[model samples]
Target chain A: MVEAEAELKRLMLAGLAGDAAAHRTLLAAVARHLRNYYRARMRGAPEDAEDLVQETLIAIHTRRDSYDASYPVTAWIYAIARYRMIDHFRRHKRRGGDHIPLDDAPELFTAAEDQASDARRDVMRLLDTLPAKQREAIQLVKLDGMSVKDAAARLNLSESDVKVSAHRGLKALMKLMADAGP
Target chain B: MKTDDLIDALARDPAPPPAPPAPRRMAFALGAGLLLGVVLLVTFFGMRPDIGAAQMPVMMKAMFSALAASVAVPVLLQLAKPGRPLGWRIAAVGGFVLLSAGIVGVALIGGDPTERFQLWMAGAFPWCVAIIPLLAAPTALLLTRLLRDLAPTDLRASGAALGAVSGGIGAMVYAMYCPVDSVAWVVTWYSVAIALCAVLGAFAGARLLRW
Candidate 1:
């Protein structure tokens, strides 16, 4: 976790320096973390977790300039995420809706774990449906901890070609995942 | 949008946004508005003519307005940026409450008790109330501009704080021309005007600050 935090901070700083790859990597990693973060907090409203994750990611992009370099990157990200959650709560409170059940404490904990595993399975299933080349490209570059350059060298492809494959693969997966949702 | 699409859209923006210096930006905007308010004050209402007799009262009003401003400015600066700790928020509220209570105490000791309500209501019935928010308009414009790009977590509260600060600065500008010498008048009427601005700011912030 400590190493992950440090790596995120480094990638974010690099992103601020106009490194697009770093920016993409940081956002991808942060999205996973945020999914877990919101899932833990939003028990009854499991669906809202994904929405909050996207909102936080967008906020991180737009408000990148407000981030102070002196602070821990996770601190900055968590603050924005927390604020976004508060906004969600405020909106729901004003509308007189209760998606977050305070009374179902034990059930919420069980539901959170079940939802998280179901989400992981759903993601894996989405990845499984992609073309072989694109799936290999994504797994090598994104899931298997291989740099695009190394992954390209291993796959006997150009670096840019590998990047395009991974990018398309992710986009396709997102569309598939969204379509597969209830 | 899905997280991936959101990420793609974010990375697609070519130019890296440089972090804005929030405090300096706020100061510049409010300072520019203060200059405009001062110009208006001198042109229309001119400073109180009796400088000798009005020294202490003028000084008191200045102190109160400035103190309120001092508390509010930091709150605006801090709240405008996410991830910043609002330790100053507590201090700001404490200072405001203490200052208000102290003003009441002064009203009790130095002020004529019988005429306090009369002076508070009568001296600046409509003009003092109306003028502060009018003067705050320019500063509010400046604030809105500065806060446009920045993300405030709580828009309503941040807006109210900005409005209150703008009002305090406006009242300070008005104090130079206001002839009323009573502490009750300055505390009561100026506060009402400032509070009105805060309410206005809350509504405006809620709509305008939505990202």
Candidate 2:
């Protein structure tokens, strides 16, 4: 990563200083980098990656003056790339398609807070396949953050019954997640 | 589009972007804005009534505005880069500290506290609020144009920073022409006016600065 950044910086500085060959070299390098970047995330959707790469390249061409020489050139390039990716997601969402973004800001991959929420949603969807009593017991005691006694009171069952249902539900959920994985 | 063809197309001579990088463009935009602000101040408002004789308080207001501008200028330059953390806490906290000092100074002068508060709230407050945004219009437009094609990851924050610097310049120019000399008034009301411009700038920049 460091070497790539250094090479990009050198090419960018040379390009900015009116080196046409170096400028072409910089654009080609960035395009190659962006292709790998979008391809890895897009997976089965390879066409989207190509489109994103082209949009990103166009942005880089026009917005070259926005680059600050004090910082690494890769930072500016990636920032533009990230914005284009976000816009891509927005367009896809608007078209009534949903996708799990594989990575968030490649360089500063901070694991977006929404990832945890998405996992919770997936777990809940899996939980719906469980028997009704078990699902309710587990949701009350686990998902709702309720005590066993409180869950039993709400379900009109004994605490031990609630515990038994929850334990059985968790065992079933383990199987469900494993089965859904493939 | 094929990567090779696109790259070859980009490699053409016109591919090299225009001169003056992001920092220099921002500097030019702000410099031109400040000059225009000064000209507007001289033409519209004129200097304060006691320019030659009233030495201490009038000059002090100018000093405060200058300090405000000094803090905001570097912040503006730093925020031009995409994804940079805006360390604006110091500028905000420092401005408040300066205003507090002025308030205390006003207290030390032994005026009636209630009446003085009313006076500070009343005198030139609306005009200060009105004029700073008016002055900031040209700066905001220039900064937006300069930033139009650039990738500012945090659009609103960049706009706010630009607005803040413009507001500081506006305050400095307004100080020259303002009739009210009280430090309390300038610090409180002028700061409010400047803050209003910052908010306006942030809103405008969010919509205008998108690539």
Candidate 3:
């Protein structure tokens, strides 16, 4: 993992030179890389998370040759993952549920007001009150299957802070749900 | 909701029917780009000395390169995939801008019909390097959306390849209608200009257009 990118470059050069076997080998390894890449980014459940990885891998395999040798493969790969996540949210919105924002670009923050509505109506219905950022941390890390580090990166907070936030968010949410007295 | 419960809520939600109307809009972008490429081509041929004249190869070589870049930029931007899908308005906008680039090239090349068009190419050739993307964002968005729709299992590569080729056609079309007679001239001056537009479009789309 430490020298993974360097190794990938060597494999890519081999593929460019028309090594068919090298291309297959590189493709297989990148699939694993894609899964881990996605896992860290998502802060949700395990089930759909793997599906996202597989879908992204399919995208990479289908379009691998387009990977510019001049660019970093890792960022290119993550960009694909990020788009798929957006696609996922769009699909979810169609199903009558709340959607999440995967804000990779400034232009993509369309309908911030709508997302806020969704947060108040749906997310608050479940968690009672834990503040927006705390709820987001729980949503991204616990349910979305994103690791603390990746969620922290997305949230622009230290990992320790996110850990604390998630802890508090979960505790408060549980108490709120429990107090509903079912 | 519990974490899994929330996940379940999201998962159980049904995906909407495929937005079939979107593809037609995307195809429209492809068509617009193709039209622009054809325009470049037409202007380029119009600039040729005459249909029957013996065409010199060296000048032809330089002209073709210029023509190719002008064409590639709009098409490449459309085919790029960084974010949400592109729409028809974007395609229409790109077509308009690429058309303007062809017009600009026409102005510069319409002079001195006796001069060999290729010689001047070396001097003003790389200008397309700056303009293609700057003024042609709609075209870039068009290309990006076009590529995403063409993501078929087997024909994906074909989609990308066709995008580049067809885009060149649109650029060429714009070139031909430039009111210039020397194909070499249009290819020399105008082709270089549009190609610069294409490069700019692709670079901007990479970041600005990414989802």
Best candidate according to lDDT: 1
Who wins the TM-score comparison? Answer: 1
The sequence of per-residue lDDT tens digits that candidate 2 reaches over residues B96-127 is 65766667576546667667765565544458
lDDT of 1: 0.78
Model 2 TM-score (B-chain only): 0.77
The better candidate by lDDT, 1 or 3, is: 1
State the displacement of the C-alpha of residue A64, model 1, in Å, after optimal TM-score superposition: 0.7
Worst 10 residues of 3 chain B by lDDT: B8-17
Docking quality (DockQ) for each candidate? 0.22, 0.14, 0.04
lDDT tens digits by residue: candidate 3, B170-192: 44333333333444444445444
Ranking by DockQ: 1, 2, 3
For model 1, residues A25-92, the per-residue Cα lDDT tens digits are 99889998999999999998878888788767767876777777766788788888988898667554
Error of 2 at A73 (Å): 2.1
List clashing residue pairs in candidate 2: none
Q: What is the C-alpha lDDT profile of model 3 across A99-131, one tens digit per residue?
A: 544553442444465666544433444542356
User: A1-182, model 2: which lDDT tens digit per residue?
Assistant: 45799898899888878788998899888998999999988899887888778667766765676787877788788878887787678444423323535553342233334446545755775565466689999999988999999899999999999999999989877865553442
Worst 10 residues of 1 chain A by lDDT: A89-98
TM-score of chain A of 1: 0.53
